[model samples]
Target: MSKALEPAGPSDGVNRWGLVDLFAGCGGASAGFLATGAFDHLWAADNDRWAAATYEKNLGHEVATVDLLEVAESSADVWAAGIRARHRGPICLVGGPPCQGFSSHVKVRGDSRGRNTLYGAFVTLAIALEPEVVVIENVPDLFATRNWELFADARSRLSDAGYRVRARILNFAEFGVPQERFRAVVIASRADHPEVRFPAPTHAQGAFSSVQEWIGELSPVASGEVAEDDAMHQASRHSKATLEIIRQVPADGGNRPIGVGPECLDRTRTSHGGYTDVYGRLAWQTTAPTITARCRTPSCGRFIHPEQHRGLTAREAALLQTFPSNWHFVGPFDDRFKQIGNAVPPLAARRIAEAVLSGGSHSEAGVVEIGDEPIGSSFSVLIPGIRRRGGRLAEGN
Candidate 1:
């Protein structure tokens, strides 16, 4: 669902903070930085041509389609050199290296140990470029027991390079996004700068956004139907049998009945139950589950629409992830899904940037204890209370 590319914003030569996105997946992080009005995107690099192209289209920013390994190990260093030539000052470096190799959900054909090396590539580039700040985003498993070695190495390297680094796991739903996506974020600043802190949650529990809140405005489309007006609104085509099975499931967050479809049961291999999210529908009143790269396919996750018998459209998924409805994604259908799913939710990233630039900690009462606090409480009041030893709140008088 590609749209007309907007012209890039003209630089005003105001010495704005510059940013370089290494694994810039379709400008998700860049969009967040731009929204803050405190930074300018100087350059973006991603090995995926489709991702880089989509980034260029939406942000009108120059994206270098290059691999990080080559940038780290090779003597050519063209990518790094080009940034130095243009930006000239200490720029911020941000990226989330591919997480498939380190994700807990990925159980076969990969090992977290092998993927740990990629973090080194980021560290190497950071040292070479000497950016004022370094930010790395990845799955929460990157800090889990099995992958702690990699996380430890990243910390040691940043310390050796003279930057003070800290890591936090942030939930998108807590930041007003309609989807439930958790990411491990590490922020490192030059030793002399104020220590970086995780951004505080702006919304909590019932106050969080729901699926209907984000995508309710779009017109409904049946399976295989494309809204000619909005390309992204087109639905994934399913077979007649598939549609029948989807229709049988109860609307609003219902899982496919066990043994109802061979394709859904195949994963269990003769067992009665398995992945519950497959062929499931979203609940209009609740937040969406994590929007994966394969979310456009019903079998990927709980991607089916609440009332519609079809998987989520690309635009719907993007909106659930807090992307602007007008922002366009390039490439064919599948690639657009990958770009959108892999992106950091812009709203979450904006709060992070605000905290980082202000030298303030995003320390809120609770990280994301959804459903614990009342919905109508004032955010200003929520910000100052600290959690006591017994997990009770010590409120201000």
Candidate 2:
């Protein structure tokens, strides 16, 4: 591997800027930044042990497996001092605070109340390190709440700390990932620095490759079949009855029968006919639905293979997320799935990182609104921040 591609320890000095990923689930954003050939991996932190281990194994850097709030209140300085000792160059703080509480999938809507506050801790860390730039990625619902309060507050806080912040929602497929994943992105820089702009899409909407293009090369395997040579390629074992039900569902974009068998949702399927994507098969010719933390399970939203009668293996899902084939994840099946699903597609991340490094923007003035045209017919929303250079949202033809 080239020096830029090789995993680096905290001390390796082969790159220009430095990056520390908070909520760094298995180093997705970090890997993307490294791939840009612009930033060196400096430090990382995550609360999950398995995620930290997976990140360390793939990136060759130790992840401080500490809770962000505790670190913020007690030992943030120590973490910042550690990074300073390793690299004195300007650093960029990048992360996606957990968004399950804000996600529409979660019932009751307000269960994990403390989760939203995690962004404040991220801001606290950014303030401690005084990084030159900060990037945050999250679910798009984060920006839609009453007046975009979460976004407004974070931008307000960063601006108070002397950074001009910009937020946008970006679709991963627009940047080369084969999955039609949409995410909210926020970028901030020192007020005196040149204005930061969101990266323009390299792939036009509906012009990108399909799921088969990303994971087609993987050898097909049956449910419960483990590729002895590749640990992540193992699929979940299904019961005999469940296997039969899955076989009955038509292949390639087929959803389970609405009112028949165990495939139909218990109450919601009959009551509201909602969640048609559950137990649906992925179409080989199209980009995949967003991979969620439960992607390893067949019942989780359109994760079934188009041809095979099984849910996606961890390896397949990772490839769809644009993770390198050689990138190894360390964890149990479910944990590995979560790490893969939560990752920022490296292709998308590399583009954004390059934009930040080059200070290249379509325009230097106004807020740049992205994710206006959702890829693969997925929903997209405009975030309220920054004025577009033209004072209008960039629309798609």
Candidate 3:
């Protein structure tokens, strides 16, 4: 909470970023942030033991599995010491508050069960740790909704801390993700530099690019079949009754025939608008719909394979999430699904990471002389639009 934490233009010693991930699941954000070489994960926390274990297993970081609400920031010193011991300074706070309340996938009813209040715990920690930079990722609806006053509270708190916080809804497709993912991202810094902007798009049209183009090479792995590099992968099992329903639905086709029923023919489904992706087969020609937790069930969403008949496996979903094929996961089957479904696409994360780190690259050109730190301190002048490219780096990496 020093004045130096107040916003300032690019300078050395301010940009060398470290990271801490709240709701860290299997280290997806950690993987992305580390891959960018912009920030190192100082520490991470999550309530799920399996997920936290997975994070610790893969990243070898001291991730804690305590409920964030109960954990006191006063006790986070050991973790902070790990950060200070290695990284220079200017830690970056990176996390995605659990967004189930604002998610379109689930109904956000019940005031008492309003899990949105958990977001407040994040800001509380933010104020306590007072990281130089903060990155929050959530569903697009997050910005549009007023759930727990968390957004309002976070906005006020960050600004009160003298941070220039900006929020924008960014599309993952524009950022190089094969899938069309619209998310709300807020990057806050205690002081000023250039206005923090989402990175520019790198995956462009007719460049021989598309969702299909990205995962086109992976041979379709049928349900129950293990991927070559996959160890914990499991293809969703379809019940006999459920399997019968999907047969009637066309690929990339809705169940209106069965959904709305009456004159059209089928009468099984009621068109509840909730279970549309059920038994659905993806169109090889189009991008896959947003990956959801229920995606493991064909009856949930368009969790079906493009050409295959079964739901996509956790590993496949991870690939679609732009995680490297070789990228590993630890945990049981269900835990694996939750991890992949909840992870920040490494591709999308890196776009912001590169942009955050791009200042050093720019300073090398003498265009901007950012301080020692990367993101919070420096602003990218050369390719400030880098965050927009999303998953495009998958091709090169």
The C-alpha TM-scores of every prediction are 0.81, 0.83, 0.73
lDDT of candidate 2 over 21-90, digit per residue (tens): 9999888888888876567778788988998998899888999877787677678788788888898677
Local accuracy by lDDT, each model = 0.73, 0.74, 0.61
Summarize candidate 1's per-residue lDDT along 71-165 as a digit string, tens digits.
67674356567777887545778898753333432355354444335566777788777778888888766666556656676677788989987
Q: What is the lDDT of residue 86 in candidate 1?
A: 84
- Clash pairs for candidate 2: 366-387, 367-386, 367-387, 367-388
- lDDT for each residue of candidate 3 in 93-137, tens digit (9 for 90 to 100): 888986443343124433343333456557767766767778888
Better of 1 and 2 by TM-score: 2
What C-alpha root-mean-square deviation, in Å, does candidate 2 show against the real structure?
Answer: 6.4
Off by over 4 Å in 2: 1-15, 75-78, 99-116, 263-273, 363-397
